[model samples]
Target: MTIADLAGTPAPEAASATARVRTPRLRRYAMTAPTFFAVEYAINPWMDTSTPVDAALAVRQWDALRSTYRTLGHTVEMVEPVAGLPDMVYAANGGLVVDGVAVVARFAYPQRAGEAVAYADWMSSRGFTPHATQYVNEGQGDLLVVGPTILAGYGFRTDLRAHAEIAELTGRRVVSLELVDPRFYHLDTALAVLDDSTVAYYPPAFSDDARAQLRRLFPDAVEVSSADAYVLGLNVVSDGKHVLLPANAVGFAEQIGELGFEPIGIDLSELFKGGGSVKCCTLEVYS
Candidate 1:
């Protein structure tokens, strides 16, 4: 199989290949972009001192974050800088790709206004369809795929309008949750559903109604702490028994191990400043 095969598309061997090369496999993913120079705003454990030093630490964090996933065996791709769009590198947020189709996101931030179009173009070039947002909904990061249904969060990175749109497009039931904090901007920031019957979350970010719904759906899931959420570690991703977490979530790794997942940590502090974690830096194609 070739890289084209992995992307679920065909590429003429002569057009881009010297010979047939083994294709890279794909995985399921939720995505996001880095906030340019946005590192200045990350919630750091050591931020009481000078601003410049804090900013530098944020960069190191981002590098560590990206490196974490790379070590876990993902084919990570970084988008080049687009002037004016600071968080463009978190390409996964521009849209959600189910299979190989792109669901163009309606960014909640006006500063990221043009990203949808640019991302759509990129998707099309890769031989994928660019699906539009239904009700101004952001993609992957805010839409949690649990079993066959999607639990969408509103108020911070998505809206009810967009929530309805996603449900219609994917033919999945989308339930909305109101975001309770600015710092946990999107659902991925506060909640992570590891499997149909398993989930991890940071309680304070959920509204009373949302919390009730979560409990009803995943009563048996392992409840993680807020500090682990800060590292965005429980944003738990799996590659067989190998689970990925943020480097800072060393303690969380222990918990994942107890659950039968071999914890693998990645340093992504710099990328976190733009408000993203392990789930954001990856694009997976689960066939």
Candidate 2:
């Protein structure tokens, strides 16, 4: 059943009644400007090099996303975009910082490998102890923090072996899930960690085994629509009480609103050309 069909009161009523139950979390994130964003090569199904991307529009949209985070009282830091890495703007793939320790990203594709080095150095410069990862793990793109667990994704961009590496690096228990859909290649693309104990996901994007795991873990999770999933709706950034997602994901927004979280929609259509949205542009830094 779709989220709307699930037995519940109207979102407006539930939100008004329960919104105060969730505590707002102050977040710190690292973002990269879309200075070098381009669809020059096809890395995922959403990208087609032939479709021209408006460079100016990309910058404007990225600026708006960054501003949105700051406007919500979250700290946003920037890493200087390198000249050759176009996908660098998808900063969540760079590396992940958790509890003051950073695990460097070892990208599965050689096309984006340089991004790992940049993030490792950047985190080290900021006083974080950076740990080099031997296995292929695309940072926060595949590694999501949910309470004490690190929900990792595999079968596409990240290697399953990387899950153990991440667990060893951060001392957080890592649970590996397999992605079956090419369109939803990363965990963040199909699932959003709404809070430490909650999530919203597109079930079809994951393998059956993975879906079972999610159901056992988050029985009350929001199952998003296929329409919203196609628009990269699950690629969201949630700070406990506030969920920020792409403007096109109206249905998913309403679903989260029913959970008493205020959903904030922002436009990142330009970045969508590069197979990313709000969460892709944002990497949480747990300090």
Candidate 3:
């Protein structure tokens, strides 16, 4: 069925909803060094601490991702990694940055709660107007920016109440999308915003209503396959023209390239063992 049919909107209405809207390209990002790597505990469905993780390999993979960003002419800033906080390496969970202001995350899990302090300090030091969130929000892990709206995910790591707080804090429109699959707990895991007007997402990760809303809004979105989604392929980072995704996601990479985007695949397998890849490692710091 067509997206218009699914959303119960006229075809013309759906067409207008996805009309091109250009926003400034993102060039700066915040990342945390994976100095301490170990899956001591499982916080998300993707984490299996019972199996051992290669700390040395994880560091090399992370460094490669950072190097990839640098090669693309993007600025990469670092946040100091604490000794015991292993999850801090996924810097996107630290907060959401938009329009030069950062809405720092108040982590839902105690394991990650302390990370808010370091993220806030870095954002403040970087000249961003930092606003600490009152409700539980996992930074950009559950928050994504599309053209003129912020697509937020709930029913997982982030609380729905934070949507209002984030909208008020960033002065942007927030649309809440409920996540259904535990594997795709964070919105970033299931959706990759390629540009202000384009996105790639896994339909099975979202609730029926959320899927319908996505259909209504992004009629031209690429629907990801289960194979790619299984490897955290949808967890990608894009800079308008280039999309950096997991090397294992060959099909998704080809699809992205066919859409006129340069898909740069980087091996983040070791980090994937910790339930994060490209997008999770890099947090956009809007200029």
Q: Choose the strongest candidate by TM-score.
A: 2
Scanning candidate 3 in windows of ten residues, the lowest lDDT window is 6-15
lDDT by residue (tens digit), candidate 1, 92-144: 56777664556887876676768788777767866788888656766766887
lDDT tens per residue, model 2, 1-287:
32222211122225656544767889999999989899989989999999999999999988987876787789998898998999999999988899888988888878898998888888988998778777888999999999989999999988998888888878999988999999999999999999999998999999999999999999988999999999999999988987778887888888888778877777888899989999999989976
Q: How many clashing pairs in candidate 1?
A: 20
The TM-score obtained by model 3 is 0.90
Two-way TM-score contest, 1 vs 2, winner: 2
User: Residue 39 of model 1: what lDDT?
Assistant: 34
lDDT of 3 by residue, 126-187 (tens): 88767987788998999999878999999988999999999998899999999999999899
TM-score, one value per model: 0.75, 0.94, 0.90
Q: Which candidate number has the best lDDT? A: 2
Off by over 4 Å in 1: 1-50, 53-73, 77-80
The lDDT for every candidate, in the order shown, is 0.62, 0.87, 0.85
